[model samples]
Target: MESAVLTQALMRPAAYPHPVSKVTLIETHISQVFLAGAFAYKVRKPVRLAYVNFASLATRHADCEAELRLNRRMAAALYLEVVPIIAGPGPLDVRIGGNGAALEYAVKMRRFRQRDLFSTMAEADQLTGAQIDTLGRQIAAFHESAPVTGHASGHGTPARIAEVMEAALNGVAELASSTEMTGRVAALLRTRAGSLQPAFHKRLASGHIRECHGDLHLGNVALIGQKPTPFDCLEFDEALRWIDTISDTAFLFMDLLHSGRQELAYGLLNAYLECTGDYAGLVVLPFYTAMRAVVRARVLLERAHQRSAAGAITTAEMATTQMRCNDLLDVACFALTRRPGAITIMHGLSGSGKSTVAQRLALAGAMVCVRSDVERQRPPHGHTAGGGDLYAAAQTARVYRRLRAVCCLGSGAGFPMIADATFLARGHRQQFASLAARRVVSFSIVDCNADLATLRERIAARTGQGRDPSDASLQVLALQQRAQEPLGSDEWRHVVRVGEPAAVE
Candidate 1:
């Protein structure tokens, strides 16, 4: 990686106006970043690529400014301002931030520890389910507020999305030596995505297609203030940033799998779905994840190709990168060739860990979950949040029917589904089993049990929380105890017994 004059000058602490004893320079395929003092300055390299052009100083300056503005959307506290590298008295001498004619520009950002980066933490096996869950909720909140593209903008349409995917496939096909599997799996994804044309349009019309963090992945995120914050978005490409929210989500989902964090991937998916209530996105989620993996493989291979052609990487390094690309393609293959879906329903009292078991099962098997409590609490199509028939018999039956429908939707799309509720009645439990039988997918029930003391304690604590969607009271628990129907022997074969142990002193 040969450095230009400005890059070399910027590698010294003296180049920055801040007082620092040393400097560190990091180089990527498209940019050179100089980390010194309490800030990091990123400068795009003078090179043109298929996806971005920074060959000219003017283009690079514009890109730097755009990077600062776009990244501030998510991490406003971290991104500072775009500053110019002014010419010094000497031809090769340059310094950052001045009033002279600019030689190059850099996006100045408040620097955090490299170890805090999600990619680095993941490498150390330090990423936690809690962090991933928080990150998912964060993304959901951001997407909810992100601006939507105008009707005239062609982004997020089937044609526009296909163009992006087709270009990625072409990149992989052109760069990789063996592209048979790539073409095959991609073809299957294309066909599946094609079948969901109306649904995609519906998603677009429903405001699911909005401006988003285009390059969302573990590498672009870091732990800041004990929270995972994202930076370094796809600033130069508006078409990539303005996309379906699920498509943005697929980037992290694919990244987690590529890193072999399968449980975290599922955790992120479940958290995002639960936060946004965007279960319909599950239909095309696998397709988007597959395409994201393909895009990843192409970018890696392309960057490796560029470096190898420039004599920057050794033959052995190039071989290793090729192997990495192959692994990425393998993730894409898994996304496409996933087996038929399964169904699991939670059978327990209100405080018997039904929700907890559903959450765990979702991570264990990449399942989509629907809870009776949440649906019961969720307002009707244009109604205010609450004040409906809290526990009317008709409302309870409606909630059960909706749960079955969500399971059907997810299972039909080849994903495991979890129905979390106190299925004390045989009829409520039978609805999910019947749907599984009709869909020809596997079905099972998780029967959770806890002592009376634990159930009472949990119910009391949850009631105090005031945030739980369940309206069940202590009196309601007593009623459930009396009215609950025990599972008959006929249902034993499909039951997975899970006991919720009483909490310890």
Candidate 2:
């Protein structure tokens, strides 16, 4: 039950009851995972960190139980059970709930291919926008089902959020490039926190605070048979796990931004709002996102410190750490300082580069783009996929309806929205214009224009690739051209031409 003995036992795969082929040991700051045949055993390290306590065998055992209980909510099949490590004559062995005095406890899990991880998929470009959309809905559903912490629980209140932010910023200030940058972040946090207090209090009153997956990022999710499953939630600290739903999701959004996947992050946010109908939650999202960035900086700083303490730090490595720290600081500051966004609609046929411009706007952090193609392909819950009728009049109407709803939701959340669609119909364009007017937000229509030959060529090329969300082909493009309505005089004033300069307001 000593550290050395535990390490030795984990190193030998034969110690486990399962058939042993090879033993893969993965270590983190607070735990060690031994992946053997058909299973992964996660054993907590005997470290009593500020946020977690796993120092004693009894404590680890209870923690393992908690991990099993909490993670199963989102990933039931993966979290198998908690097993005990029993002492033996020659070596420590996993008892699998047999009768014996246990030395330590490990959370057992069904082993999965590392390649199926969301992070790995992202690196390989195998993660689709539709999958990201599904992930948001799943998270929203999870939050809905999760037990809400009572207001009296003293968790997830505006005061607590401010307290946590101040503590986290103060804790990481020493690692910042200068005290001035730290001071600026603190000031921004104070201002944003004060502004967001009312929204936070409202969320707390409305039961939006619940137990959440505190560490939701690409790494904690995996594609199991094409379903994105999130696991390995923070089980050690209730304070960390119980939070406003948007704040919890901001971690994933901030991670995507950090990794340069801002477009997907924006789509995920839009889809989450569509699922949860919590548009007002946007008021606190910037603050939550900044806090997540600051948390990432704190972690990176801790890593740099550990390397420095060990006398193993290299100049290049130190430089990389410092650069990342500065980058996160900048992101935190940017999120806090972002201007209120306006609604923009991409108005053009598929081959005209409407999606491209929409994505550009989203990456610029101007607004979240909601695409008609992706949403059309996504079937409702318990519904089967329809055929080529996706472009039929009724189906097209449904798509536009959904698009309008999503735009309204985003606008209500105070996020600028971009409707990425052909918008070939004046009625559809007017619907969004009306929504913008009602929402009291500025509106603009981006008309992507190209020659007929160029449009045909682009559509052909896109169809050949077969990876595009759009299914439009030359025939479809022709049909669209014939049916498309030109922008009206009123709509022309709001149109921004993408290709050639046209007379505009």
Candidate 3:
């Protein structure tokens, strides 16, 4: 194996024995990727960075194998095998079984078109809520089956988390819009880090820390055969890969928000919670998201520095990069702000704009929403509302009971929460108020009132839409109007109106 042979093979596609009509070479800071026909080959550079070391042939071989093994767990069909680039006596060739000593190792993968990439789809506005839902479910399932890294693993401790945060802050401090802002954020992060020490310890004790896809973002995910598939996980460092499961998810959540897909971010988080029943994870989300933001800013700064040093960056390009870094820092600061906790219950019939208001509130970072329509159609409440016993007296009571119980559980976790439901019965409304009182959280009712004609029209239009979660019809609205109870004088102070200019009663 000679250096000249390996270099020539990398530069010229004619070096390989296979038919190569066209070739493309992609180079990153630490790797070189060659795309030929139907396969992509990745070779790690022989360099040592602060976080990873691939300076020796042995180290490169190990890291290449690690990349292949870890990525195959999620992208099974995409990751093929690690093949050797042998320097034969005549010419360099990629051989399966030969006696020639290998010059380097490359991870061979089944390549798909760039259009299938999630990043590409996002640029084309092709990223959909359904795709985000599939991604959430897939990641949740993967985390559930991942190996747990508990306190014994010593990777997800509070101190370790603080180290990562500090590193990220230092990494991007020079590139930030203001050094004072960076210092303030660093101080705030330290303060919060101390506060979350107990939470980190608790999650570790509960086995919430596990081996994860450390670099989860839009660019790392792709749609293969119309299904969301995550790939290209962090493989060089164990400290990066072994993390709290929620922190792993926060990466994608932050990426979606940064990409201006706020609704999809909320949907993804809600769907993940539905799959894992890990609503408690919400407690650490602010910190996790902030950390993710800092990490992203650091990466952007690194790229900007590299381009500037290479004289490839224009003044406008550098300004845009700086703006992006500033934006991410702002997101971090916003995520760190403590939001008020309250129980906001929506009281209205179907199509009264309750869901719309609740969704808007959730997107505004006010609270996480729990909708009755979506819940009732799932699990034990999987009943066809009409002829079946679903709307029967006892069954209706059970549904409300379940909804109230879910609200209680969510509020107990210390998050601001919105319970979206048609609280037509005084008993049901009072039940939530009492629960909120017991939890020591403020309770408010939003009266999503509209004209009778408007409500009827909306109901009919929604029913015809066919994909709405609610099964309510004009008949349901008539029954509700006759049976609905007005808020008592005692509850007036806590009531708000959604459809009016003035929100409060």
* Highest-scoring model, TM-score: 1
- Model 3, span 1-505: residue lDDT tens: 4433555566556545566677788666677788887788888877675667888889999988999999998999999988887765454554432456777888988888888888888888889878988899999999999999756667999878977888899887866767876877787778878988888898888888899999998888988888898998999989889998999999999888888878778878877876775766877877888899988888887777767887878989888988888888887887787543678889877667888787777767636777777665554623443445444567677667766776665565446788888888889888989888888889999888877877888889889998777888788788888988888899888898775622322
Write one digit per residue (lDDT tens) for candidate 2, span 1-505: 6786788877776677778888898766678898989999999989875567887888889889999999999899999999988875675544444668988888999999999998888777777778988999999899989999976899988778877787789767977676777789889999888877778888898888899998898889998878999999988888888988998899888877777777778778867865665656777888888899888888777767766876868978988988888788888898888654578888887677787777767756747777888877877545787766788898899889878877775566557888889999999999989888887789999989877877888878878999887988788887898999999988888988885522110
Query: For each candidate, how many residue pairs have backbone atoms clashing (under 3 Å)?
Result: 0, 0, 0
Q: What's model 2's TM-score?
A: 0.75
RMSD to truth, every model: 2.1, 6.9, 5.8
Q: Cα deviation in Å at residue 379, candidate 3?
A: 11
**Alpha carbon lDDT of residue 302, candidate 1?**
80
Where does model 2 exceed 4 Å of error?
91-97, 176-178, 303-318, 345-366, 369-414, 419-442, 446-491, 496-505
What lDDT is obtained when candidate 1 is compared to the true structure? 0.85
TM-score of each: 0.95, 0.75, 0.78
Backbone steric clashes in candidate 3, count: 0
Instruction: Give the whole-model CA lDDT for all candidates, comma-separated.
Output: 0.85, 0.82, 0.79
Q: Candidate 1 residues 1-505, lDDT tens each? A: 2246667777777778879888898877788888989999898988887778877888988888888888998899899999988876666677889898877788999999999999999999999999999999999999999999887899888898888888888888888766687778668878877887898898889888998989999989999999899999998889999999999999999999899898899899888887787888888788888889888888888888878887898989888877887888888778777766899998878788888778877887777788788788776556777565666778888788778877877787778889888899998878777888888888898889988998899889989998887879898899889989999898999999885355211
Pick by lDDT: which candidate is best?
1
TM-score of candidate 3 relative to the true fold: 0.78
